[model samples]
Target chain A: MSEVTAPMAGKVIDVKVNVGDTVSEDDELIILEAMKMEMPLVAPTSGTVKEIKCKKGDSVGADDVLVVIE
Target chain B: MLDMVMTTGVVHLTVGNLIMWLIAFFFIYLAITKNYEPLLLVPIGFGILIVNLPLTYLMQEGEGLLWKFYHYGLEWEVIPPLIFLGLGALTDFGPMIANPKTLILGAGAQFGVYVAFFGALILGFKIPEACSIGIIGGADGPTTIFTTVHLAPHLLGATAVAAYSYMSLVPIIQPPIMRLLTTEKERKIKMRQLRPVSKKEKILFPLVTVMVICLIVPASAPLMAMFMLGNLFKECGVVKRLSDAASNELMNIVTILLGISVGATMSAEHFLKPEVILVFIMGLIAFAFSTAAGILLAKFMNLFFKEKINPLIGSAGVSAVPMAARVSQVVGSKADPKNYLLMHAMGPNVAGVIGTVVAAGVFIALAG
Candidate 1:
C-alpha cells in the first residue's frame, strides 16, 4: 500500500478520490489549504485507492497520511 | 485655580484634538478587535492619542521621546532599511528563483504607481507629493515611508498609514478586482508544478539580484543592500544566529519604534487636511489600478506561452507579501477547488517587493 501524505500543514479542502477509485501517478487526490493557499496533493503511484483518511475541511499536518493506495 | 487649570493640557485641547482622539480610538479598536495589522496599529493608535494631547512634549523636537524616534530612526533613513533586512531574512525566494518570468509581473504591478503619480498631479499635487502618494499602490509600507521621506517628508504620515492600511485590506480589496479583471476560465487554469530549486541557486539569488538591481538603481542600495544581506545570512547556513536576530529580535525592536514614531507624526495640525483626505482617496485608486494591471498583464502573457498561467495569481504582484498571494490563492481556488496556486502566486508576490523598491529608487532619483 502506498500512503499519500500532506507536504505541508493545512486544512483539507477537497478529497477527489474514494476507496476503490483507481488513480495514476501524479493524479491530484486531495486539496489542502495552507498559508491561505490551496495545495493539491497528488498520488505517488498508479494504484487503486485503498483508504480515504481525510475529508473536506479536515486540518492536517505535514507528512500526515491523507490517503492510502494499494 | 484658574491659572493652574490653564497650565493643564486640557485648557489647550481643541475640537481638532478631540477629533484626532476619536480617530486614534477607531484605530485601536480595529487593531484589537478586528485584528488589522495590530502590531502596527496599536502602537500607532497610541502614538496618535498621546501626540494629540496638547503640551505633552512627546513630539517636541530634540527633547521628546517619539520625536527622537522619528528623527534618528526615520529622518536619518535608518528604520525602513532595517525593516527590509528583517523582511529579507523572513522571505523565501525559492518560488521566484524557480520562475523568473514572475519578475515581470512584479514590474507590471508598478503600473499603478505611475498611474497614481499622474492622477495626483492632475489633482494639483506637486511632483514630490504626487510621487509619495503614487507609491502607496505598491502596498509596501517600508518602501512608501522610505520614498516619502526622501521625496516629500511632509506627507510621510499620511502615505505610511495609507500603505499599511491598504496592505491589511489586501484580502478585501484584491478579490473584487481579481474577479472583475479575470474570466472564470482564466481563473481555473492550472499551472504546472514548480521544479525543486537547488541550494546553490537559492544562495546565488540574493547576490545576483542585489548586483543587478542596485547597479541599475543606485539609490535603492540603502534598503536593497541590507535586504540582500539579510537574505544571504539566512541562505548561507553559516550564520543562523545572525539570521535569527535580523528576522526576530531586531525586527521587533525597530517595528515598535517605527510604528510609534510614524503614528506621532500625525498630529492634528499635520493630519486633518483636505489634502490628507485626497491622499487616502488616491491611495485606494493606486491599489485598485495595480491589482488590475497585474491580472491584465498575466492575461496578456498567456497569449504566447504554451504553458498557460492562471491570471488570478497575477494580482499577487502588488507585494503585500503573503497576503496578496493568499488573495490569489483564495480567489483561484474559488474557481476550481482542485487548483493550488499559492506557491505559484508567491513568485510574483516576492518579485513585487523588488519591483516596488526599484520603483521607489527611480522616484527618488528623479524627484528627491
Candidate 2:
C-alpha cells in the first residue's frame, strides 16, 4: 500500500475519489486550500484507492496521510 | 491691526505654494479616483499639502511632526528596513527556488540602474546624486528611499516620488518595452511547470542568503538581515505572532509614517528645480532599460536552452512586487489567452527584489 500525504497544512476543500476507485498517477485526489491558494493534491502512483482518510472541510497538517493506494 | 490680522495667513501664500498645492491635489486625485497606490500617495499627497502651506512651521527644522518623522524614521534609517521586514514576511520564495535560473534574469534587469547612473552623470549630477537617481530604475521604493537617505538626502523627495510613481506605472511603462524587444513567438512560448520547493529549502534560503550576501557585501547586511529575519519568522511556523505583526500591525504603522515623511521633504524651494525634472526623466529610462534588459537576456538564454522560455516574464524583473509580474501575465494572455505565466513570472519578480538590494549595496560600497 502507498499512502498519499498532504504537501502542506491546509483545509481539504474537496475529495474527488472513493475507496475501491481506480486512479492514475498524477490524478487529482483532493483540493487543498492554504495560504489563500487552491492546491490540487495528486496521486503518487496508479492504483486502486483502498481508503480515504480526509474529507471535505477537514483541516490537515503537512505530511498527514490523506489517501491509501494499493 | 484689524486689517493685518484678517490677511495674515493669506499674505503668506506665494505662487510656488499655489503650484505645489496643485501638484499635491493631482496626486490625491490619482490616489482616490484613479486608484494608484493609494496607501502611499494619499499620505504623501496630504503631507505635501501641509508642508506647502506658508509659514505653518509644520515642516520646521527640528520642531514639526513631519520633520520629526523624516528625521527619526528616514534619515536615521529605521523605517525602510522595517518596511523590508514586512515585505519579506509577505514574500514567498517558492517560485525562485523552484527555478533558480531566473536569478540571472533578475541580475540582467539591473542594466537599467547602470544606464540611468551614467545618464545622470552626463547630465551633470554629482556621483552620489546620480547613484540615488539611478536606483529609481530598480522599481523598489524602500530600497530607493534607503539609498537616497544615505547618499543624497536632498534628492530624497524627487527620487522617492519618482521611484514610486514609476513603480505604480509599471503596467503602463513596461508593456511597450516588452513588445518592442520580443517577437510574437517568443511571447507565446510556454515554460515548463516549476517543481515544488520543499519546506526545508524554504527555511534554509533566508539564512543562507543572509550569510552569503553579508560576506560578499557587508553594506547590505542591515537591510538584507532584517529582510531575512522576517522571512525566517514566517517560515519557522513557531513564530506565527511575530510574522503576523511584521506583516500587519508594524507594517501599517511604518508605512503611514514613511509615506507622510517622504512627502514632507518636498518643500517648494527644494522640489521645484531642474535636477528634479532630470530625475523624473531618468526614472523613466531606468524602467525602460530594466524591462528591455530582462527580455533581451531571456532571449539570449534561449539560444542555449532546448526549451524556450516565454520572454514576457523578463519584464517582471523590475521588483514592483506582483504588479510587474501581473503585467507580464496580462500581455502574455493577450498573445495567447490559454497561457498561464503568472507563477513563471513570479520567479524573476521576487528575484528582482533581491537583485535591487544587491545593486544598492554595490552602490553604497563603491560610491558612499
Candidate 3:
C-alpha cells in the first residue's frame, strides 16, 4: 500500500488513529494546523497502518509520508 | 410659434454614451476573457450599459427597476449584511486558527487602508469621504460599499466602482508589485509547516473571537458577526442548509443587487471629478502597500522561526479573498512544484478580511 503524506507543512494538531488501526480512502487520519487552519490528512487508500511517522505537536512538511498503510 | 428639438430621444445617445458603452464592453470582455472576478464585473458592466444611456428612464427621478433595486437594496443597507452572510459562509477560518501569527499579516495589510484614507484627506476630501475612499485599499467589495454609503454618500459611485474594478484586476495589479518588491530567491522560500487544530478548537474559535472583536469594535459587530456566523455554521456541521444558502442563493442574490447598486453610483457628474482620479491612483498605491506590508511582516517572522516562511503568502493578506490566497500558492508552485502555499496564505487572507472590517469600523467611528 502507498504512504499517505501531508499536503502542507504544519504542526500535527491531532492524530485520529492509533498504530495498527485499519483505514480506508478519504478517512481523515491526522489534522495539521497551518496558517491558523486545520487541514485533515485523509487516507489515500484503504490500508492497515504499518507506521505513524509523527505525533501530536510534531512539525511536518508537504508530502511527508504521514502514515504507511500496508 | 416654433419648437426646437435635440436628436430624437433614442438617437440622442451621443458619442459620450458610445464611449461609455465601449468601457462597459471592455469591462465585460476582460471579465469574460481573462477569467478575473467575473461574478462582479460582468454585472457591474451590464449596469454601466443600462444606466449610462443619457436620458434613459432607468435612473430618472421616478421608479426605474434598477434604481428601485439600488435605492431599496443597497441604500437601505439590506444587501451588504446578507453579502457578509454569504462571505461568512464561504470563508474558512482554519488558516487563521492554525497559524494565528498570520493574523499579524492580516493586520499589517490594513496599513494601506489607513494610508489611502490619509491620502484622501490630504487631497481635500472631508473625513467621511476620505474614509470611504480609503477603504478601497482593503480590496473588499462590500466593505467599500458599506463604508461609502454610510460615510461619504456622494463619492459612493467612484469608490464602489474603483473597489470592484480593481478587485477584478487583482491578478494584473498584484504581480508587478510582488516582482518589484521581492527577489526571485525570496519568492521561492519554502515555509515551515503549520500545527494541527482539533475540531473542537475550530468550533470554539469563532465564538471567542466574536466576543473579542465585537467588544473591541462594536461598529464592526454586524459585518463581523455575520462573518463569524457563517464560519460557525460551516464548522458546527449541523447547519448545512444555512451554509449552502449563505454560499449560494443568498450570496448570488446579494451580489446581483450589490453589483448593480454600486455600478449605479457611477454617474457622469459624480464619477468625472478630479477626486475620482485620486481614488483610482490611491487604489493602486493601496494595493501595492498592502502587498508590501504582507511580505515585510512575513520576512519579520522569519527571524524567530527555524524554517523560513515563504514571504509570498504574505502578499495575499489583502482581502481579495481566495484569489490572493490562490495567487500565493500559484506563485509558490511556479518556483517548486512541491510547494503549495494556498492554505498557508489563506490564514492571513481570511484574517485580512476581518482586519479590514475592523479597520472600517475604526473609520466609521472616527469619521462619523
All models: lDDT? 0.91, 0.89, 0.80
Cα error, candidate 3, residue B259 (Å): 1.5
Better of 2 and 3 by lDDT: 2
Each model's DockQ score: 0.22, 0.06, 0.09
Residues B259-323, model 3: lDDT tens digits: 77766766555566688788888877777788888888888888897877788888888998877
Best by TM-score: 1
Q: Interface RMSD value for candidate 1, one decimal?
A: 4.9
TM-score winner, 1 or 3: 1
Candidate 3 DockQ category?
Answer: incorrect
Fill in the DockQ of model 2.
0.06
Task: List candidate 1 segments past 4 Å from native.
Answer: A1-33, A36-66
Pairs of colliding residues, candidate 1: none
lDDT of 1 by residue, B1-368 (tens): 99999889998998999999998999999999999999999999999999999999998999999999999999999999999999999898988888888998988998999999999999999999999999999999999999998988889889999999999999999998898888899998988877778889989999999999999999999999989999999998999999999999999999999999999999999999999999999999999999999999999999988889899888999999999998887798778755668888999999999999999999999998
